[model samples]
Target chain A: MSITVQGRQAATTAAPAPPGGRSRGPARVRWAAVAFVAPAWLYVAGFYLYPLASSIRMGFQDYTVSSFYTGVAPYVGWDNYSKVLHDGHFGETVLNTVLFTAGSLAFQFAIGLALAVFFSRRFPLGGPLRSLLLVPWLLPLVVSGTAWRWILDTDSGVLNHVLLNVHLIAHPVPWLASTHDSLTAVTLVNIWVGIPFNMVILYGGLQSIPGELYEAASLDGAGGWQRFRHITLPLLRPVTAVVLTLGLIYTVKVFDVIMILTQGGPAGSSQTLTTFAYNLSFQQLEFGRGAAVGNLLIGVAVVFAVVYLRATREQRQAGR
Target chain B: MSRLLRTSRLFRPAARPGALAALAAAGALTLAACGTGSGSGGSGGAPDTLTEIDYYDAAPQNTQLPQILDECGVRNGVKIKHQQVPRAQFMPKLLQQASARSLPDLALIDNPDLQQVAATGGLVSLSKAGLSTEGLYPSIAQAGQYQGQTYGIAPGVNGLALYYNTDFFTRAGLEPPTTWAELAADAKKLTQGPRYGVAFSAVGTEEGTFQFEPFFWTARGNLKELDSPQAVKALTLWKDLVGSGSASKSVVTWTQADVNDQFMAGNAAMMVNGPWQLPTLNADKKLHFGVVPIPVPSPDAKPVTPLGGEVWTVGHSKPAREAKAVAVVKCLLSQDESAKWSKDAGYIPSNQRAAAQLASADPQLAAFVQEVGTAKARTTELGTAYPKVSQALADAIQAVLAGGTSPGSALSQAQSAAKN
Candidate 1:
């Protein structure tokens, strides 16, 4: 509380002071502000920034399993990157990552939005049902992935058993084992795992939309769809932007799901960039190439971050 | 417009403190979750105490190993602080510690991974440490060697063999097959509605490759050439079983544990597994399983399975600490101690002389012990390159069984991939 008061007082006091003396006013206030942010700054720098920088630097070096112990990896500029780019699996992996991210986001968002709107029309047990929906998001991804793996088993899984008993299909589908089906299977599992996150965020957004706007729109002769189109969506634009931007960042790094489900197997049909990087580093001990793939992944996340920052800035300015 | 902008819900400085507090709470939670494990009590140049680590998280190894370690610790005149990590995290943890130069005084490493760890030059050669492996199986001893220097040794070892449901064989009026052809015919004849005739791991892991190697090596497939006709023959056998529905398509996902589960659940009449499953199988009072050498291509073709087990290794430490660790290893590998460990852990003693006596006393382990004489060290030919090749072979098995690819082409592709 005092920090804010100090900041405001310094800003006011600095304005009237001479140029040379003005720095003294804000400098004292700045130190107080920095004190408030120090812990968070240290957290981000240690966990995120340091690891990212090391990964990028390692990508240019000839790192291997032995390098970890010896700490003697030599730099051979661009060699790791070239190897990753020219690799035959790289193109297909990129396509898989794109399809996985796009498909998961589209379904997760659409289904989540629909559910959010439905729940907005409060009914019996509404609050309980909303809380129940968050169970998926609360569980560890490893536990969820293992449960889904059992459910999607080819021969004895409950899914195939039910489908076959109901005569939904003549033959059982190999959900996890087949190359053609694994991508779809993992994506479906990821969608299930991701839906609760979307629903909760969207539900919060829905609740914050004032009820009077709908009432006012209805009085203006705006029907259900018309009111939704004019009032609800426009008001929800900021929330939607926040949701989709965060969703893109999270989905692009989806590793644990695909890993536990298939380990990106069956001739690497379901391999994504994240699992590919893991395989290169852990399985094959080609740490440099793994870091290169990891850097490429960071590039993807950075692109989304830049676009989000720009769009949100524009949204803020346009609101004026 | 400016008043609206100033009062807009978007610029809710009122919410900023709450968000930051929540973030701080989250950061605290994450930090707590990722907190480093308490530093192990024994450290650098310590004479009176030493540290030992291994992945023995399951019974009876979990129970049995600690007892033996305690005894050895007492005999070695030092207090041993033992730690157990989960199996999957064992190698990654060891590597991290190696990088930090903070490895335990002694580590129990999987035999196939021995070469990879040894190659990092962070292990003290047993010979240099004045440790002798005089009575151990040559292959078992050889598994712990890299570039002709012994770095580790095991008290007991394991290998894969065919474990059949004896009741199923008696009911079907048949004998356990000695050759691949009879094995297939018996498997088909025994298969009933909703029950697979056989189960094995083809689960895209080292275990899957471990199970595959009996046939692979019997047909003369070497680690160097994955695309050889012998390798394809081995893969084709797996394909034929799954394609014929004698083995479930789920074999592509089943680990050895899962295969044992299927056999115990009556979903399968036979499984290819190791001595490690004996205790679990015996725990089910109704289940009766028998062991045999894994069937080869023909009656006379020798079944060459891969040697399996963890070897006790001395990590680089001060001379006194390493000497203490070596004494503990020696105590663990003594003839009497090895025999007791083999009995309790369901493993065959690595000392061949001790194993022979144990085999006569316990017929359940005879087949695996016999195979030990012929079982190939997975790291022998390719050393550290073996893991990449094994991974390729595992993927090839998955492709042929689950992806419907032909064995010939799948193995060739694996060969190409591994070569690159």
Candidate 2:
């Protein structure tokens, strides 16, 4: 029975290959390939595809805690989506999400590029300093966020203390406590967390560029700014595209830093779409509405991903 | 092939680890929902053990409650496996279990949440199972009922009270405030460098609503009419406290636990908190604190604090297993056991007789015991709709305190939100 089963598996593995390849060795290779690919395919199907599909389905259903027990979530067909979209708080949440993502990406990429260029030049202690910069990226966001929360506490926080001593302002800033400042405070912490990630990737891309290009630019009597602008910028385009697209995806869905710091409030002032969705589902038990918000976020990420893929494809074709 | 691998590696990037972290963080809620739903219980016949779950993830209760459960289990001729999750995750986890039909045989749920969970039809009607609320406090008994069926029963219950530093009050030569006027005046007098006159949670969660409800109810504010003049007045009191710097602007961000920490650190002269802080407070030998009923709107008005505590519940399961669980719950809620649990856990005994004895014996509990008599159950008026109103109330409190929104406007907005 074992031999027959093995024969059947071998036949299945060989059937999908090119018409020329039917030998035992090639069939065994094909079987090994199946063995190699099976786990990843199963993992993607189980973790990503299944949950994504369930979330989409939930968005169109009137799911509640009662629905969980009775296994009867009545389909509502866009009611959840329409309700959340037209809700009073929805517009503010969308604005917050956009501000947070744009602010974090713009500053993170700028600071990261500057650091990457600065570190590219050989200097004393450069290697150790570059490695040390990664400490922020390595630590969990929860830890970083908690530390920042203490630092930003309005009354006795170290940031206020330093600012007071330096005469930066007359009074302390209510960083996480006031609606006006909470979003800015969370955005600042997010940029701090994201800088190291951006720097390391851009730095790696910098290393891959041939040093001879700089030498050729210099021979042509190109100044430092000219060489960096004309040569380095164009060469770094692909890496920069990857960095920004990935950064957008990561930043738009940021929940922990905001949660640990402000919990998406001082009256929902810092609430982005991610935290809003969480509040809907878990806090209010409006699971369908929460799923709708989550789907909207996923739509944003999908739009950016498609844009990135198309841009990269065009670049490839242009290169050819 | 090599070129293709290099191109794919470019897309993957060295930020692969960071990308993976983002994925894990983003998927947290969905992943929690996707937990394995295997029906993890006995197949048939009489099971010799039962499962219990609760959110008693703090020190005395975390260590003490399980020992009590084991004692009850031993008496009932069954072994018990007890589990705990953090408070925030408790309901979500329970709903997950209910969906799978693998709920623990026994559950200890928070009182205000009883109606919502019971509405899911996942709990056994304890009244039908021969459990009685005969001698329990009326508020606690009412909190455990859903649509006239008793689905839960508390061994002990608690309510919010004002916690003040006795040392600060003595130095300031003032009594603990009894009316809103005195409370505000005393709070302002107590304010000095690095010390706020008072502190309380206004964080945007149910704890905020729980802390604020005493004031709201005392001012004759009804949960059903959140934007009523009385509701606006109740919120205005909090706004004035923060606006006057008698309370920290940071109250908008503080939780009850944070309020306790500030009170202990001498950063705040007083705080609105619950009896649950007693164990932690008493553990600090140097801190001298006193508890009093939260100040009322007038000397003539009764302070109506929200009832707070957890209740023991039986879950749907095999009759034999559920019967055993009910026996364990009865043993846990017996007069002697309830008194002992209350003492160990810093809760007011749900039984009036036991609570009276406890209050007489322990001075710190006297205030809480007095309030629990007239304390209102949060869900009695709104039933399963209480959580939404509570959330709206919490948001109004935060908005009035932190966002500079007038109390009238905030409550008006909250009223609309609760309506939705």
Candidate 3:
């Protein structure tokens, strides 16, 4: 390198060389790097970590709106947590959340997979069709929720209007008037919002698979279904795993759809943990109990994240 | 040598005091700008300057109150920024703002939420503000009082009334019943085709509680005494109305708008509605209607109507803001402004003199005024526990009506839940 004395080599070799032949120079560089990252570190510490710590602390207190204003929210040591666990609706909320998440994920993934397959083919209008399909996803959540609400209204909704006009039934459907229908309606709205995301991710995954693998399968006399089964499905397993995990995490925290569409109404049949936590905090002004519910949600999410990370790491190790 | 180099790098960009001073000055200016316009009265002593007041009125913005307020502002020196939040969001938003100590200078507080606000120490006491309750309607003014002090000012009054579609009534050959029993019987007679005999908003909120209050009071029962025999009887009548198919089970989730929609669509013969629906009913030419006091269970019993209205209040945390807020309140409650408000907003004036003046101008409003005398204040305790108690009542009512729970059992549960 000394004989060549090239700029690239000099620049590359300059990093390890130090004045006074001391390793402390590299240590100082490390310190400088930390200093550069300090602002971002402090931001996360203040905004995210501090609030999260405070929320956990508040969960143990007998916090209420009255107490918050009066500055007398005394710590009650597990009382708030106990009260939430003992509540009659807590179990129902958990069950509903799980059902909603599972139901939405299944339908969204299926429809999205179907759309991805349909669009993967070289068609004349594939580009335009794919773009057109994203309208529902492009809509703001509140707008989507409201539009669905109008479509699902028991009396004058478009769905009922169309059904009745076609003589499908003699009566108007109570789309949001019953527990079952309300749940169904909310799930449908969620599925609609989630499908485009699934489609986009799966389409990208589908495009990455080598054409040679499919060609080899075709040369071996593999049928369309066989080619998809052996080649596409096996290759997309990693993408599928990622999609399902991310979708599950997102769907479990579904609140806006429930809140706007049904508001956990028809006797709170559509209530999820997120809405329950919200109602507890904002509606009931029971911040301690709300925080307890929030902590439960965080705990569930952490467990999910851990399981996902473990599975992903194992898969990566196997791949290596 | 490395240490020396590192130390030089660290001190390379030394802090500039002049630049830091400028940054600090900018922050101070921003903070001062944010602080200056806050509170009831502006810090600078300029009485003639327009005081900006934020009012959260649930009245539809397109209707008369906003228009009248705008006109009044031009006539008077004061300026009001009326924000029409949806009815369901108004109280919660107010509560949130109050909690944050970022409440507007003036807010239209619902009567039922007054106690909750007062408990939070968010409202400025009217007595302390040198405002006398002498000119206001006693019962209406009493609605805003909590802990022996007035914290809000009622500009108008509202109560539950029997609104009958004249067309439906005529088609069914039924007259508006004067007693609860007659109303039930008449409702049965009116139940034909797609139209229901009676429509009541049994939704999970104050609407359900307020609508049911008349029935309970007429039966000589109180929400406080939910286990009483009369309470059971009142609950039984509501259940019977739903169970017998005279009233729709859909009312359990129906909002005021739902009831109004059904009534306007001619799907309901008679509905238990409030004064707020008057303007909507008046605007629809095809639907003829009449407003009468809510019927009682027995003819001997007095017709009891649950009182409803909004109250104007200033935030207590900001004393200077209260002065500006009081000015806005005075401007809103002025006789001429109050008359226009009552006329356009479909609310009965709290100013008795304003009511008297308007009563002669509109005969229908005068008839409404006669019913105001019998309007009973909602129980302050129930009003305080409104969020919890109302949901409990709605659930209990729905169970009795839909789930076949006995009224006696349903009422017992309601009482327990309300107390808890």
Candidate 4:
């Protein structure tokens, strides 16, 4: 009896069933679709949409414990956003955020692509080498930041010790003391943490491409560089887009690296938008202004997402 | 129908299972509550007490607190559960928890943040708890008092003091500085190599403000009277110290740990640090140091230090827990416990009698105790504005030390910033 019912259900539910054939009612179909999507819809509503709305609401008022019971947070529309925009360090923080994001993405992708290409070929200790490369990503952010800070310390860092012993420079450089050096140091650490992700993603992309396509190119007398540029690069476009978009979004929200390394200092030289927002809210207790800054971050991420989606859609159409 | 069933396979069973389990749990909890409420209410039984105390401490767990708590709890017959949070995150976390009406029963609050808590009705008034504020060091107690009511109580005291390396002084053939001019001159003489004569945590935040306060007080300047000629002189002394290369530019960003590291490495001859660093210094065999009251720029001026410390207070709404909270606080703040805590933690005692009792045992603590009497608690109103005010001061100091701006101009900018 169960086998006969299962066969009838399968025949009725098959796509493009013969016209007027035995079929489940549309109401049943709609209910099934709702049942399938309800879990994800609930999850997004509970976590993402709820918090986003709360943050937006909080951005308009001086929402604090002191003001909560009194219900006296005067609505100063756009004032918080205006104040943050006009702050003296606003320009510098924006610039730092852009530079950090662009720099990390560029270096991480380049280094990772090279590693992926190298690892795609069979080599001695290939498995172990790949595992070792994953160590930085395996460590927690705090541990990585702290280890980097120690290694980059001005007086006692191992980096300085090695360089000075090798007679690389006459003076010990303060890696975190100056604005430029601190940026470089933090970028180095970010690149270190970011490379493994890029490698794994790109390697998977590389493995998916057919060997026949490359063999055909080689038969046509294609050079190594030409094969990489014409074949590998073109094939990796989708992965590249994903990597760059994700990397940009992640780097723009950088906090722990800067916080643990320089704390947006020697003179607020390394302050990024996220750290600025953090300081404004927690340290200065200016929640409205912090939320304004955070909203700006969301706006940036949205813009990047739109651009990435457009690019990916264009690539897919061209492939078709 | 089969395709629809396959597509919704994961969700159909999950929804039903979750709903059933939640309903069952709720029914069980309701039944359990009914049973408990009907259970025996014995008058002879100990009170059902669960108190959560939030402790903002950076001290290592291996030291004083566990031992002190064990001894005190046995004596007082109370078991206190402490949740240790880092000092930097404590205030903000407490503020969030306060808004949710879930503040801990007791908290170790900083002096500056205490005003905000008091303003928000986050703390309970100690007088309401039957605790007397009499015979307390007025300045120390001033930290926890808001609107003429004591909302918190200082367990111990910390203040800025001049720490000089005896070896550096001997090598430079100079005595420990007694005045600002002497300090500068000594610093210049001792700064022969990579080593600096003096170091102060002029980094942004309370550290710079605390270090700068003595200079301002010594020159007969005050925070309220920023435009005073004395203030300029005091400001210039700091400018000259950094300007002349007697102090390292590192001071602009150095924390207490940085100052200690420099002193330990013998890179700095003198530092204006708090009592918190004393334990580390004393434990180090390579260094011989002496602690003295911070000197003023003017020889005739009385030396002044800035008083700082933590306070223990219960949440405002926890009346039922008040009896146990008071018992724990009283036990912890008793003269014996306070003295032991002061000695062990390298902080001055909040209780004057306890301070004297500890001083007789440790001469180093005596110097700290003597300084505490002269220490000035930051103005109550100004303390409330500390987060903003301190940041402004730190930025100004950083600017001056980094040679990007002059002290006079920096102070003017800082005053404007502080006003906002």
Candidate with the larger lDDT of 1 and 3:
1
- What is candidate 2's fraction of native contacts? 0.55
**Under CAPRI classification, how is model 4 graded?**
acceptable
- Tens-digit lDDT track of model 3 for B142-218: 78888888888877887777888777777767778988789889999988777789899876556777888888778
lDDT of 4 by residue, A246-283 (tens): 88888888889888887877667778899899988887
Candidate 3, residue B366: how far the Cα is off, in Å: 5.0
Top candidate (lDDT): 2
Give the candidate order by descending TM-score.
2, 1, 4, 3
Model 2 CA deviation exceeding 4 Å by range: A1-38, A215-221, A315-320, B1-44
- Which one wins by lDDT: 2 or 3? 2
Task: Give the lDDT of residue B404 in candidate 2.
Answer: 92
Instruction: Name the runs in model 1 displaced over 4 angstroms.
Output: A1-40, A208-231, B1-46
Lowest-lDDT window of 10 residues in candidate 4 chain B? B38-47
Q: Is candidate 2 or candidate 3 better by TM-score?
A: 2
Return the number of clashes found in candidate 3.
7
Candidate 4 Cα deviation (angstroms), residue A216: 6.1
| Interface CA RMSD of each prediction in angstroms | 8.6, 7.7, 6.7, 6.1
DockQ for each candidate? 0.27, 0.31, 0.27, 0.30
Q: What value does the lDDT take at residue B66 in candidate 3?
A: 63
Clashes of each: 0, 0, 7, 0
What local distance difference test score does each model get? 0.85, 0.88, 0.74, 0.75
Off by over 4 Å in 4: A1-36, A68-72, A117-127, A165-168, A206-232, B1-62, B70-76, B192-195, B224-246, B381-383
